[model samples]
Structures are given as structure tokens and as C-alpha cells.
Target: MMATVRNPARDAVAFVGVGTTPYLRDAGGKSATALACDAARTAIEDAGVDLADIDGICGSSVPTVSVQAALGLPAVTWWSNSSLPFSLLVIEAMNAVFSGACTTVLVYHSSLRGAGGSKTAAADPFRVHNASDAHGHNAAMTAESPSGTYGYCAWAQRYLDTYGVGRDALGLVAINGRANAARNPHALFREPLSMEQYLGARMIREPLCVLDMDPPVDAGDAFVLTTAERARDLGHRPVLLHAATSGRTDRPFADQLEDYTISGKEIVAWRLWEKSDVALSDVDVFFPYDGFSIMALSWVEAVGYCQPGEAGPFLAKHWSAGENRVLIDGRVPINTHGGSLSEGATQGAGHFREAVTQLRGDAGERQVPGAATALVTPGGFLWNATGFVLRGG
Candidate 1:
């Protein structure tokens, strides 16, 4: 039995507009700020809302004030610059609209290839100066540090060891994303990736190959949000926020975390389901962050799609060998827009955008048929983990 919890914000706010810049492997000399502005303008136009209507701005990496100024919004009464993974900003903006802090909000997330991203990025003095680890953390990454690559590598090995699964578990995720990407014009890698290629890809970290990791890229994704009532009268079909929340554990540090099972995704899933009328069975599409393929595998279990250690069989059971994608029970599609693995990492912004696109019936070739509800688990199973349930009316 589960205790019923009432959430006033449930279905009160919605995503009315979504926009994206090309998911680029090359920066093309565009700065992160420029990419943000580009996406914001596109979202604003997509919403068909006048500039004066957007009274709030929210995002990650880029300051809210900076985005407001770049877009030349007359003024914004409320703004917030949340931390990485981007879902925090989405929740903040939704609350702001519901609380009367702002009527309509513009949210954006932008990523630039820093010096550490690639040799090409390193050649640019601008990128070099702003260099940080894969996740914008300036810390020196190493096997000694259980964050970024190290954390996932250790967790992946544990999952494999404990479950007696093989590369097929993680490889399916990569192959699925690549197959989906083949139809996504905005994807960074649109070619089909085979299991043979995935297993053969040079190992960056043992047990995790280059294919298992998300590549760094310069990109941006943005959304226009407002009260569900207001959204219904806007440019696109409103994707209501059935639930939105972020999570963290007492052991905030990656090393302090007990193990794979004790982390943020548990809390995120707990709160999300408790607050949502839409259950796991009702979800028409799913987006699990693929910053690391292990994170995606962990999410399906944490969210109750399967029991821990069953992800391998669960995935294998649902995989469409013909299409090379994972379709849950032949009804739901996972990450219709390729996901971070092949779509280029936009933190979790791209995941949300793709969800909204599918919900609004605007995903073009990648659209899930009659997708009405989408369950998105973004960020990692760490301090930044978050979840959202979106339903189209």
C-alpha cells in the first residue's frame, strides 16, 4: 500500500514551447552564451507569446539575467540560475508560475566543448580558459575521484558483477539511441551502431567502452513554460507537468554514497510516483539520462520498470531487433530523440525537449504514435537526480 500525497502544483503548470539548436560536435565558433540566446529566441517564437508575456527566466550554466538581456525582454520579475542536469530549472520555473512569482517563463540550458572536451576544443583559447571536467566541474578527474567517468565505471562494473550481465545490457542502450538518432535530424550521430561495433569500440575505462559514454558537444535546448490554463491557449498543445522534483541523499559526495542502490534516483522516483496520477503503466514514452549508459540502466530499475539486475532481460525482451530500438511492450519508446549517447549531452535539457516534442505530436519521424504521457528521469543517480511526468492534453 502507498500513502496518498496531494500536490497543488500537479497539472497546474505545463510546457507550451520547446526549441533546440543543432546538436553540434563542433562549436562552429559559437559560444555557449550565443547558443543559449539562439534557443531562447526560437522558444519564444515557438510559444507565440509576446516578449512582455515572458516575465521569468530560468536555466543552468547561463545566468537568467544574461538570457533576459540577450533576448531583450523588456524585463523579468523572477529568474533563477540552477545547477547542472537542468531539471532543477524546469521545476523552479513551474513553481514560479504556480506561485505567482511569474506568469510565463523561459528556460534554457547550453553546453560548450571545453578544452578538456576534445583536442579541437583545446586548441581554442576561449575554450581553454573556461575548461572544466566533462560536467563543468573544474576538479581534476581521476580513478581516485568517484565522480564523472570514475563513478559510473565503478558502478557499471558492480552492476555487471552482481547481476552476471554482459556488455549486451549497456550495448543495447547505445544501439537503441543510434537507431533512434538515424531519424533525428538534430542528432549528432545519425548512423546506425551495431552490437559488434559497440563491443569492439576501444575501452576508455575497462568494462565501459567509448560507445558507453556520452560525447561532449556544443549545444542548447530551451522551453517556454506557464500555467496549464495559460498554456492551453498558446501556440502548441500543452504538455502538463503531472509531477516534477529533484533529489539527493545524506551522502552527498559520490564516494560517500553506499552503493548503486542508495542514491538520488530512488528519492526522485518515490516522490514522482507519489505525486502523479499517471502510473508507470500509463507512460507512453520514457527518457532516462544517458550521460553514462549505466545511469540509464539504473534508472529503469529505480523507477520500478523492472527489479534491480533485471534490466538486461527487461531490455532484451523489449528490444526491436528490426528497428534496433527499445519499445516497452511494443507501446512505449525510450528516448525517441536519440538521448545523450548519440544526441550530444545537453545535460538533461535535450531529454526534456524530446519528451515535450513527442507529447505535442511534433517529433516528426521520431514521434511515438499517440504519445500522451512521458516519464523522464534526468541527471544521474547522485545529488542532481530529478524526474518529471508530462502528459499531453
Candidate 2:
């Protein structure tokens, strides 16, 4: 007879461990494959689980076929080779667990674009093309020709003019990230930024300065997920993967959205709250997406942290400790690892690890004390979003 395993409970999958390499827009020492493996090794080790225990691999579509081979996994039963946000990958991991497809799954990604290698007509499983890389009027990416349908500046300009958000508001973003990164040894940018300084920065696109855009980073990050019961056996703290929710807008591209002002963050958050059996006050910290500062603010509101058009004031108080301290009320502290703006974007995996670290109390120096619950939100704005709730077990 076969041994029977059942779902642990309602919202029972747990995040056992996480790891990542120092993010770099242009990493020098290793190829993207090697970088990705480095994070994978750290994650499994952190979990205190044997390599053979991992029966599944969930890889993002970026660095290419080297992940499973590098990790020496038996097979990658579950995987996503699209630029689909990392948040979606976590949901896939949760589904794998729910379906009894794999006991221990590894989710990982590493970007090789820093090498600036040329892309041709060749087809690669791990290197699925993204709209952002499209070419036409600007073969090498000029201001006039958008590489994809949703290219930079087009939506940003619309949002700015509609919201009456001035450049100074955006400057606040660069200043905040630069300051937060200064204290993060793993961060790529460590210098403080002033409003005047941000204003003077090179404008990459209309209404978007060089600093406004998420840096083109070459880095790798990985995390491991399994049932809470398995986690208890592994001797590591089990961070329960309580909820995973995803939402899509009617618009395939940014241009299709009827209201750029209409946010999907609330819809996703609502779904998560409904499924997780948890409430907003239950989360000790938050790790909402930070692809852009304004987007983060938008998410804050969308997720019911505050009312619409009130995020600026809420942020003013919540993140007021000069980017290091968590509010006493924060059982789920928001982005203690400095988020994407400070720690460098790992496609959305950076946010995932930060939330996991907080729950596991492994964030060292940046750890939130007695962090029992955390919320990890990833993905992109005006596109898709994913949220996960975890509690210390």
C-alpha cells in the first residue's frame, strides 16, 4: 500500500527557507547559471534539508537550462519559463503542494542580461522573449521606439498627469531607496540621494529619470517551499504559506486597461484575505512590490493598509525610522530587507525572501523582533500581482 499524505490544513503550506546572491546590474564573476545555483544552494542549506529531499524545481524564465542541471536535481517536474512575475511562481508552488505533485520544490531565477549578449531568432526554453525586449524603430532601444506594447514612459506619463504627481513626489522614491540601501551591505546602491540630486539625474524617459527606473540588475535569488509537517521534521522554523492569490486585468498590455487608475492590488488582496483565514491586522509586516516607488504606494492603498490617495501620509509615519525600524504594531513588518528599491530587484523573489527572513528571524541586523506573521506581495503594477501570508510555526 502507498503512504497517504494529506494537505496539512487550511492555508498550511509553509515557506521552509530562502537565499539570494548579492544583486548586481552587471555581475562580473559568474554567469547567470552559476549565480542562480549559488542562491539555490543557500536556500536548501538554510532549510536544513537534504538535496535529495527536493523532488521538484520551479524555475523562472531567464537565465536558461542551467538551473536543474547545475543543482543536479533528479528532474524539474514543475517550471515556468516565462517572464511571468515571481509571485505567480509561488502560487504554482502552492498548487504543486496542494495537488501532491511534489513534496519539496525549489523556486529560483537569475538574469543573464547583464552580459549584454545578443538575442537572435534562436529558441531557448529558459530565455522566452518578453515584450520589453521587442524591437522595431529602435533596434537597440531608443526613446522613440518602444521595445514592447507597454514600454516605459507611456503609462508613467499618463499616471503622473492624471494624479497630478510632480517630479518631487517621484524624487521621494529615489531618496528613500538610496537611504535604505546605504545600510544594506547586500545592496548595490549605497549612497544617499537628495531631492535636488534626484531632479538633476539623467531622464531615461519622459517623467522617469534614470533613478526612477528599476536598475537593470544581474542577480539570482531562490527559495524552498514544502508542507509544514515536513518543515517540522527538517528542524527549521516553518513559515506557513497561508495564502496565495493572483489576479489579472482585462488588459493584456498596459494600453488595454480602461482605467490605469483602477488597481488590481485590492482584488488580489481581497482574494488572499478570503482564502488565508487571516485579517489585515493579523500580518506583522508587509512586503508589497516595489518595482517603482509610486507603485508601492499604490499597493499600500489597494491592499487596505490605508485609503486611496492617503498612502503618502501613511508611509511618512510607517517608514519614519530612517528606513530601519519597524513600528511596534508591526507583527508583519514591511520589507525589512530594503525591498527592490534598496536591495535590488530579484524579479519578485527579493520580496519573497525578505518576508521569509522576517518570519524565520534570519534577517540578522535587519530582523524584526518576534515576527510571527508576514505578507509577501510580488509581481508588477498594472499587470498581475501575487500575495502570500506566512506565520511562524
Top lDDT hit: 1
List, residue by residue over 248-333, the lDDT tens digit for candidate 2. 66663555565644545665776777767678787777776776666666677777877765565565556545443334243344
List runs of model 1 lying over 4 Å from the truth: 1-4, 132-134, 139-143
Residue pairs with backbone overlap in model 1: none
Query: What C-alpha lDDT do the candidate models reach, one value each?
Result: 0.86, 0.66
**Candidate 1 residue lDDT tens string, 145-261:** 676567778778888999999988999889989999888888899899888999899998878998888888888889999999998788799999989888788886766777778
What is residue 229's positional error in candidate 2, in angstroms?
A: 0.8
Top candidate, metric TM-score: 1
What TM-score do all the candidates reach, one by one?
0.96, 0.83
